[model samples]
Target: MKKHTIVALVQDRPGVLSRVIGLIRRRGFNIESLAVGHSETPGVSRMTIVIEWEDVEQVVKQLYRLIEVLKVSDVTDDPVVEREMTLIKIHAPGPKRPEIVALSEVFDAKIIDVGANTMVIEMTGSPAKVQNFIDVIRPYGIKEMMRTGRIAMVRGVRGHNAEEFVENANGHAERVPVMN
Candidate 1:
C-alpha cells in the first residue's frame, strides 16, 4: 500500500463533505488525513485527502460520480507542496523552560504562549517535520497538542481550477466560468 494524496474541489454546500466521506468509506478506503476549507472560488471548497491505497484512480472516478464534486486529482505522483501545522503545549517548568525554548528554536517553531507551568509551541512544515518535532518533544510530556492535517497543492502553473470544466447531466464535459 502506498500513500496517495488526492485533491478535490466540491460545491460549498451542506452535507457535501459528509457525502464525499461516506462514499470513500463505503468503498473500503481508509482516509489517513483530510484538510478542507473554502477555495479561491467563492462557492467552492478544496479538500486534500491522504490515503494509503493501491487503486487510487478508481477512487478519483468514484468522487466524480457525485454531483457536488467539481474536480478530483490524484497528485501523489505530481510535484507538489505540502504542509501541516501543529500547536503543542508541553510541560515547561521554570527549570526546563530554557531547554524547551531552545528545542523550539532549533525546529524553527514559535513560542506562541508561555505560562507558569506550560508553553505552547507552534510549527508549520512538511508532515514529516511536524511529526519529528512531536517525537523530539514527547519526552518533555506533552500537555496538549492540535494538528491541522496535511494540505497539498500541485506545483507550477497547473492547478485545480473548479471553473475549468464540469460534468454535465449527459456525462459530457462542459466549460463553466468561475463565480465570484
Candidate 2:
C-alpha cells in the first residue's frame, strides 16, 4: 500500500474530531499519523492525516461524507513542507554529557533540560531527520520519547485555507473564494 498524506478542514465543534476519526475507522483505513489543531480561521480546524492505503481517492471521498469535513485534499504528491517534533529523554551521565551535547548540536536539536543522569532534547525537523537523530542517540539509552505526528502544508502560495470553503444553501461545501 502506498503512503498518502491528506489534509482536512473541519468545523471546530465538540465531537467533530471524534466523528471524523470514527468515519475513517469505519472506512477501514489505518491512519499512520494524525495531527489536528486550530487553523487561521477561528471556528475551523485543520487536520493532517497520514495513512497507508491502496487508493487515497476513496479515502478523501469518505472524509467528505462527514458533515463537519468542509474540505479534503490529498497532498502526498504536492510540493509541501512537512515537519514533526520530538522530545527525547536520554541517559546523559556526566562523562557522556559533552558528547551528547555535541551530537545534538550537529543535528540542530536543542537540549531543553538537563538532569544529573539524563537530558531532554527537543528536535523539530522532517520525519527522516528526526528518525536519524533517534538512531544516533539510541546507544546512549533513551528513557522516554514523545513525538508529535506529521504536520504538512503545501509550499508557496497554494495552501489550504479553511475560510475558502463555505457551506452553500444546499448544505454542501463549495468553494466561495480563493485564499492566496
Candidate 3:
C-alpha cells in the first residue's frame, strides 16, 4: 500500500468530523494522522488526513462525495509543506537534568516545565523527525505524550476556496470556478 496525504476543507459544524471519520472507516482506510483547524474562511475547517491506501485516486473521489466536504485535494502530489507538534514528558532525575537539557537543546526542543522528577518538552517538526527525537529520549522513560497531529498546505497556491463552489441547477454537483 502507498501512503498519501489528503487536505480537505469542510463545514466547521458539529458532527462533520464524525461523518468524515465514518466515511473513512466505512471504506476501510486506516487514517494514520488527522488534524482539524479553522480555515481562512469562517465556518470552514481545514482537515489534513494522512492514510495508507492501495488506491489513492479512488479514495480521493469518495472523499469529495461527502456532503460536508467542500474541497478535497491530494497534497502528496503537490509541493506541500507539513509539520507536527508533540509534547512529551520524560523522567528527569537530578543527575539526568543536564543530560536531558542537552538533548533538548540538540533537538531544538523547549523545556516547557520541570517537575521534581519529570520534565516536559515541546517539539515541533516533520513527523519522522519528531519520531526520531522520541526514539532518542526513549531511554529516559517517557511518562506521557501528546501530539497535535499533522497539518499541511501547498507551498505556493491556496487550495479551492469554499466560496467558489456554486450549486448547479440540479443542486447536485457544485461547479467550481476556474482560476486563471
lDDT on C-alpha atoms for all candidate structures: 0.89, 0.88, 0.84
Tens-place lDDT per residue, model 2, 1-180, is: 888899999877789889878877886778889999987766678999998888789878988888778889999999999999999999999999999999999999999999989999999999999999999999999999999999999999878776675556654446566556
Give candidate 3 misplaced runs (Cα > 4 Å).
158-180
Q: In model 2, which residue pairs have backbone atoms overlapping below 3 Å?
A: none
Off by over 4 Å in 1: 163-180
Candidate 1, clashing residue pairs?
none
What TM-score does candidate 3 get on C-alpha atoms?
0.88
Clashes of each: 0, 0, 0
Which candidate, 1 or 3, has the higher TM-score? 1
RMSD of 2: 3.6
Candidate 3 residue pairs in clash (backbone atoms < 3 Å): none
Q: What is the lDDT of candidate 3?
A: 0.84
What stretches of model 2 exceed 4 Å from their correct place? 165-180
